[model samples]
Target: MSQDPGLWTVLLAMIAGAIRVSTPFLFVSLGECLTEKSGRINLGLEGTLIFGAMSAYATAYTTGSPWLGVLVAGFAGLSLGVLHGLLCNLPRINDVAVGIALMLFGTGLAFFFGKPFIQPAAPRLPGIPLGDWTGNPAIASALDINPLFFVGAGLALVMAWGFKTTRWGLIVRMVGDSAAAARAMGYSLGQVRLICTALGGFLSGIGGSFLSLSYPGSWNEGLSSGQGLIAVALVIFARWNPLRCFVAALLFGGAGALGPALQSIGISQGYYLFNAAPYILTLLIMIASVSPKRSLKDAPSELSITR
Candidate 1:
C-alpha cells in the first residue's frame, strides 16, 4: 500500500482498467492458442479480429440485440478461419502466406461493412459492480469492471484444463506434434487442424464483439488498433498456457494504458514510446520464446514452418 492517496488511486484504477481492457486480448489469444496447438498459425487473426468487430457492431445495431451480434461475429470469424485452413491445406500454399492474404481480405471486408456501423450505437455490455462497497463516484469509476473480463478469465481456466485433461485435447496435441504418429494411430490430421482453426476463429470473433459492443459501443476503421496482432504475441508469451494468457493480457493492458495514465497526472513524457508498448513486448517475448535449439528440438516435428 502506498502512503500517497493519488498514487494509490492510480494503481487501483490501473488494476481495474487492466481487467476491463484485457478481455479482447484474452479471447483472441485463446483462439490463437487452439490454432497454434494444432500446428498452424493464423496471421489472419488480425484481419479476423477487425472483421469480427465490424460484424458484431453491425449485427447488434441491426438486430437491437448484443448477444445476436456476438454470435454473428463468431460465425464470421469461423468462416474466415475455415477459408484460411482450406487454403493452408493446399499443397503449394504456405500457412503464413495464406494468413497474409486472409488478413487483407478480412480487413477489406470489415472496412466495407463498417461504413454504416460508424454511427450506430448498439446495445453496450453490462459491467459488473465492483465498487458497490464504496459510495464515492471516483471509487465506482475506478472499479467498474466489465463482465467480458470475468468471462475471459473463466474461459482461460477452462482451456487450460481442457488441454491437459480431455480426449479432444490429446488428439489435437498429438496431431500437431506429429502427423506421422497421428496417422499411425489412425487419426486424421487435416480434420484436427480444421476443427482447431474453426474454434480459434470463433474465439477471435467473440473478442471482436467485446471491442465494439462493450468498449466503444461503435465501430470504425480504427476500433481495434492492432489488438489482433497483440493477441498473437500474447499466445507465445503464455507458453501455450491459457491461464498465463490472462496475466499476460493484463500486463500488456497496463502497458497500453501507461500513456493515458501519465497524461492524467500531467506528466506526458515518452508518449510516442508508450504507443509502442505492445509491439515492444511482443518482439521481446518472441525473441525469448523462439530459438534455434529449442525450436528444432521442442517444436512439433510435423509443423511445416518451424522446422
Candidate 2:
C-alpha cells in the first residue's frame, strides 16, 4: 500500500472506483442471486456479459443513444437466459454444459460484431454528483461516478426487501430450497426457473452493457476479463443476499481497481499481481464459504450445485 501512495488515498480511490467498477458485479451477482435462490445456476451469464457488451455497443452506435443500447443488451441477454431455461427443462441437457456453450457463443458473437466498433467510443452513462464532501480534485478524479452505481445500490435495497416481504421472493426461495416441496405446493418448477432465468439474463445483460457503454466506454476483445465469472463467484461470497451482494461487489470492485489506481498515481507495483486482486479475493471467499460445513446446512436444500 505504501509503495503506491498514502494508505488513505489508496483506500479512497478504491472506495470510489469500487462504486463505479462494481456496478456490473452488483447487477450480475444480484441476478445470479435470484437464479441460484431458485435452485438453478446460469453459468451462461459469462457469455451473456460479452454478448450484451457487443449488443449494447452496436445499438448505441447505430442509434446514438446509450440507454437504448442498454435495453437491447438486456433483451439479448434475456434471450440467452430463456434458452438456458428451456434447455435445462429438457430431460438430459445439463445446465452447466449449456452455460459453457453460451459463454463461447456469446463471446464469439460479440467478437464478430465488436470488431468494427473496437476503434470507436460510445456515449457513456450519465453521472450524478455525490462527491461534494471533498474539496480535493484528486478524489473526484479518482472516481468516475456513474449513475448506475447508485442504481445498483438502490436495486440491492429493493431486492433485499422484496425477498423478505414479497410473496414471489418467498415462493422463489421455496422452489430453490426444495423442488419436491415446491412441487407439493403446486408450483411449476419449469415456469419458475424459466421466469427467474430470463430475469437473471436481463439483469446480467445490463451489467455487461454497463461495462462497454458506460465505465469502459469502448469495445475490444479484452474489454471484459472474467468479470462475469468473478460475479458468479461473488454470488457465493454474498451468501445469496442481495444486500450482501452490494457490499461484496464493492469489495471486489475495490480489488479490481487497485492496479489502475496505483498506476494513476505513478506506481506500477507489479501490475500483473494487482490485476489478480479480484480473482484472488474471489478464490478466498469461495474457500471460506465452502469450508464452513454449517453454511451448507443453512443453504437452500435443493441447490444441487452447492450440494
Candidate 3:
C-alpha cells in the first residue's frame, strides 16, 4: 500500500472536496428556497434531480456537447415542475402528497430510460484551472474548480438581492405570506406558485447536470444519494434566506468531505460511517433548529409545515 499523506494534504483535500461536493447542495437548496418562498414545497425534487442527471448524461452523450445537456436537464426539470404545479392547483389538492407522488414517478422514469446510458461514455463539463499557478500537482488538481460552482454562487447572491429589492420578489413573498392578501392585491396565487415551482425545478435540474457532467462525471441511477431531499431540510435550516442557504451548503459540503478527506490520509477503517456525516449533521441541525413552542419567525405564514 502507498504511504499516507500529511495533515496539510488531508486538509487541502477536504477543502477541495467541500467546494466540489457543495455545488449540488447549493443549487438544490436555492431551488427549494424559491419554491417554499412561493408557498409551495416540492419533495419531488429528488426525482427531478435524478431524472435531470439521466437526461443530461444522455443528451451530452448524443450531442457531444455538455452545455446542451445542462440546458436539456433544466427543461426536463421544468416539465416535471409544471406537472406538479398544475396538479397542486386543482381544488382541494395537497401540495405535499402531490410532490411525493411526483418524486416516485420521476425516479421511475429516470431508472427506466437511464439503463442504456449507464455503460456509455459522455462528455463532461470542463473545469477552470484555478490552481495552475500553485506549482504543486496536488494543489493544482484540488483547485481545478468547476464553472457551475461560480454560477451557483452568483445565483445565490442574485436571489438574496432580488428578494429584498425586486418587484417579482415582493410578489412571491406576498403570495407566500397570505393567499387571501395576494388575491385582494389582484395577484393570482396559483399562477405565482406555478411559475416559482417551475423555476425552482429548473435550478434543481441544473444542479443535477453538475453531478453527472462535472464531479462524478457519469450516469448512474444512484447518483443523487438523496441530496435533493436533504435540500428541503437545508432550506429550513437557512431560514429561507438565499445568502444563508449558500453558507449552509458549504457547511454541508464540508461535512460530506470529511470521510474522504480522512481516507486520503489512510484512515479508511470506518469509511462508510464517515460518509454518513452529512446525514448525521442534517439530523442534528433539524433537531436544534425546530421547536414545538414557537414557530420560525421568518417562515412564511402560508407554508404548510409552519402551520
Candidate 4:
C-alpha cells in the first residue's frame, strides 16, 4: 500500500525529528536519573546544557575537532556540577536553591564567552546512515543517526543492569532510598551525592554537545529551550528507571517534532501552538504522574522535594 505524499513526508520528518531532538533529552534525562538515584536533584542542568553548547561550539571551532568539543563540554558541566554539590553540602543550604543559582551562573557564563563564537562555524558530529540499504533518500536521511544516540542507548541499558547488579549502583540506590541506612552502612552521604551530581552534569554536557555539534548545528543563546528542566520531570515520569527515561525522552522528542512536521506538510495554522507541544506534554505528563492520595510510588525517599 502507498501513503499520501504529504502524510508520508510528515511522518518521515517526525521520525527524523524525534531522533534528532531526542539526543539532548536522552542525555539530560539519563544524567538526571543518575543524580536522582543518589538522592540529589540538579535543576541547574539548564545552565549546564547552555554552557555545554557554548563550550562545545567554541572548542570545536578552535580545535577543529567535534569530539574534543564534546569532551570539553563534559568538563564544563562537571565543573558546574561540582560547584552545585559543594554548595548543597554546606550546612543549611538547599539543593534547589543552589541549582537555581548555578543555572543563572552557567547561562551568564555561556552568553559572555559565547559572543565571539556566534558567527563562527564548528565541526559537526558524524552521523551513521542506518537505512542505506533502503534505496530511499527520505528513509536514509531519517536513519542518519549520530554516534551519541547509540552511546545514550547503551548507557541506558548499562544503567538498567548496573542498578540491579552493580555494587556502586546498589550503594547509590541505598543512599537515595534512605540516608540513615546508607550512613549506618558507613557510606558518606555527601560524597556519594556529590559524585552523582557531577556525573549528571557531565552527561548533561554531552547532551549540550549534541546540540551544537549535531542538530541545529550551531551555538546560540536559545539552544536548550528547557530540555534540561524537562529532564527532571522525565526522571519523575520514568520513576527513576534509566530504561524508562530513554523511552520518555523519545516521547518528548516526538512531541517536539510535531510542529515542524506539521509545517513540513503545509499545516501552517496554529503553528505557534504546535511548537508549544513539548511544554504542554511536560505539563500533562506531570499531572498524570501525580496523585493526591499519596506520593509517587517510585520516588527516591531521601529526595527533599518528595519528602
Q: Give me candidate 4's TM-score against the actual structure.
A: 0.96
Cα distance off (Å), candidate 2, residue 45: 0.9
Tens digits of per-residue lDDT for model 3 on 19-65?
99999999989998999999999999999999999999999999999
**Residues 1-307, candidate 4, lDDT per residue (tens digit)?**
3348888889888988988898899999999899988988899999999999999999999999999999999999999999999998899988998999999999999999999999989989989989899999878987899999889999999999999999999999999999999999999999999999999999999999999999989998998999889988888888889999889888898999999999987789999998899999999987886782333688888888888
Better-scoring candidate (lDDT), 1 or 3: 3
CA displacement after TM-score superposition, residue 112 of candidate 3 (Å): 0.8
RMSD of 2: 2.4
lDDT of 1 by residue, 19-113 (tens): 76778898999999888888888889989999999998898888888889889999999999999888887777788888888988999999987
lDDT, model 3, position 118:
97
Runs with alpha carbons beyond 4 Å of true place in candidate 1: 1-3, 294-298
In model 3, the Cα lDDT at residue 159 comes to 97
* Model 2: residue 232 alpha-carbon error in angstroms: 1.2
lDDT by residue for model 2 (209-297), tens: 99998777787888778988889888877778899999999899889889987776667979989989998998887777776574464
* Candidate order by decreasing lDDT: 3, 4, 2, 1
User: What lDDT would each prediction earn against the true structure?
Assistant: 0.82, 0.85, 0.92, 0.92
Residue 194 accuracy (lDDT) in model 3: 98
The TM-scores of all predictions, comma-separated, are 0.93, 0.92, 0.97, 0.96
Worst 10 residues of 4 by lDDT: 288-297
Error of 3 at 245 (Å): 0.6
Model 3 TM: 0.97
